[model samples]
Target: MSNISQLCVILGDQLSADISSLKMANKQECLVLLAELQDEASYVKHHKKKIVLVLSAMRHFAQTLQAQGWQVRYVTLDDPQNTHNFTDEVARAVAEVKVDEVLVTQAGEYRLQQQIDSWQSSLGCTVRCLQDDRFFASIDDFAHWADGRKQLRMEYFYRTMRQKHNILMEAEHPVGGQWNYDHDNRKPPDKSVPIPPPLRFAPDQITSEVISLVASRFADHFGDIDPFFMAVTSEQAEQVLQHFITERLVNFGQYQDAMLTDEPFMFHAHIGFYLNCGLLSPVEAVRQAERAYMEAGAPLNAVEGFIRQILGWREYVRGLYWYHMPDYKSLNFLSATHDLPAFFWNGNTDMHCLSQSIGQTQKYAYAHHIQRLMVIGNFALLTGLSPEQVNEWYLIVYADAYEWVELPNVSGMVLYADGGIMASKPYAAGGSYIDRMSDYCRSCRYKVKLKTGDDACPFNYLYWYFLDKNSELLANNPRMGMMYRTWAKMSDDRKYEIRNSANKFLRNMS
Candidate 1:
């Protein structure tokens, strides 16, 4: 009955201790392979913090496996025997240690999916790429939910999830008697409200070593590489989640769309990386936030809004990824084509809003939700870069830029490049929104309200220019009809001036 005939692959992101593969290990029979592949890091010149977090977590997980009496063939990026790639290293391990099958939880990426799926023939063994099963839903499970639906909506899917998991519910309904509490969550953060600082973890030696390696290897990559500190382990992830629910979840929804001065992380749970890398489960994160609300009568807006994001929006994004990818990544209904400005790479810019947003991106690789959606995404939308280019940039720039989730958020939700498939209409805007939400406008030399002038806000001119340029496509769309009507009232000469000013801004940027 010696069943030690299978090989289990433990990827860097697959550090979850409760993963079925670990519990399924036969101790003496199966070997878990964790390889540090060069291709993974260099694929996009990923952020330094992302590189350090994964490598450090992998080492710790390998030790956890070893302590549990499972054989772990841990290979470093610089290992002499390293094949320098994931599949090559996995194939090498499989051949050197004979196995009947290779078991794995699926990778949350398109590039790796093709690699893993094809390796079965090369290894001359069955490759059982099982579902990651870490999410509240899986690709298969989500597909099942999508079956026969005329159109998909996260609200409906999320309600199904709530019922299926019996979370935040009373008998058959959501506890608040309605499926949503969106109304309460829209209030901006009050100056009188005292918010707590984010939970921080000291960079242990393991993490510090990874940082050193990243610094040495990727000295020329875009974005900041310094002062990297956040969750790197499951314990750290849990502690961060705990702090979020107890101290911040109550206000998370209210200020979810609000922006504040000098606060990047803010009430936002910087736990996306943890959830993305498998340190935390989405359901647990949502459930805990819900629990905090019930126990403390936390504002319904705050609780409901936070719950909807994780249980509804995050899951919806994942399902959309599986439902449409490869093709989804290529959809550019708007047909936008321009270069992302040089200012995006470094924080060097005179436009205060752009400078501040880019500066935060350099410092922490994070921008609050509004800053991302209305400012960065809005700017990109108006300037009109090809969807693929903008998608690639977003995928590489953020801490949470895994293609599975980031693509739709960028090309579809952000750029409106997928037309109306992923969004009802464009999230178009002018600069006044940014002015209202941030202090950047005050410091900015450009005039936020000016549509055309030597120093008019490029955002204002570009905003009108984008709408006018795309009026043929957007004018009839119900979501934007009102705006288009307003546009129709504007003089033709004003439209000419806005486009002219926007052109100058782009010319100057280059």
Candidate 2:
């Protein structure tokens, strides 16, 4: 048996070379453990592509550590002796290697964090759970910023992060004399504009093996495993980042909110898949976008918008997740109880917007934020889908989704199930918003212009339906006053038609 000083556990998501536990370890004395466990893979029937991405990334990262002179213990999912759980694997490793301590970065999800919390008593060793410093704001840092604030807004938190990081700052003011250029950035998709495809990497030998394993074992999973083009290593991930900075950043902000049919990767960075998994650093991605602006390679709207997603929204959701967790998972501020529609799994819906968004997700395990937030997520919101089911569906579908980031976005932003904690008002919108923002409505069977009848867009009536049903909860909200006033002015017969249309749609869905 090798005499090891510590067993450093690097999780599937914690694949970064600069992970805190790895940095704290004496590479010569500590054994690095990277395991592909069945339990984690089967927890929610994750997309096959997501499973392959994580396992392949983990395997590649293990090789990187070994080449760097660290002793590594790699466990494959198909290994005969695998216990398919973290605690059991850690115990087995502790028994095999003479180690005095177990060092690990904090788990990204609350359920996993509970298991990590028990390692000391169960493993009978000193278990050190280090803060994941990859993020700009630590859990404590966010809590401090959130403390005593009646309203927790991403804009204020984002300004603080920009100032703290000196990202777009010139002394006390922003470079463009504005913290946000979103007004300049929301031009609807111009079909005439040239759109570059996201950079795709051919699967290497290690990733090929992972694809084969996931294809067979998770044949029933949500997404297609093959034709997998995700970057599985840091070098490849960096290539993706550089590709975005050069090719996509200039138009990323302008068309960020716009959606086009059959054009899945239009002017989007597609780096969230890499950034969330620790294959690429968020700070590095943010800095590169800033540099592009400084070099006149990309516009201020593009650079600032891209940086805000990572520095502001990404960090904010993570902080909110940790701060409100355990109980945060169960929040149902709207008391929504509808089961997730079966269409979410297979993209079998008449709404072209949803079908396009979900179909893209199933094919690639990727969807840009607008598709997620406004199309698919907005549908879930208006339909009164159960938050738990909605949250699980999101976590299962996206490669970038972990509960820490996914839950807050779904519960608070999408479902409004967290009340007003994450958003001032629900992001509910009618088909007019979709028609204006996307090309999906042009092809949709539902009439985007109609407000009632079977052929009318479900989103049109459902938007009013959601507001009416939740008026007791949302009526007094300042941001919702205009929407309520619009509703109030409608003739009683008109209101009845909207409610009836929504009811019929909900019934048909069930």
Cα shift from native, residue 184, model 2 (Å): 0.8
Instruction: Output the TM-score of candidate 2.
Output: 0.99
**TM-score to native of every candidate shown:** 0.95, 0.99
lDDT of candidates 1 onward, in order: 0.80, 0.92
What alpha-carbon RMSD in Å does predicted model 2 have with respect to the real structure? 1.0
Q: What lDDT tens digits, residue by residue, belong to model 1 across residues 336-377?
A: 888878777886777787777777877776776777788788
**Cand. 1 TM to true fold:** 0.95
Candidate 2 residues lying further than 4 Å off, grouped into runs, are none
Residue 387 of candidate 1: its Cα lDDT? 80
What pairs collide in candidate 2? none
Worst 10 residues of 2 by lDDT: 1-10
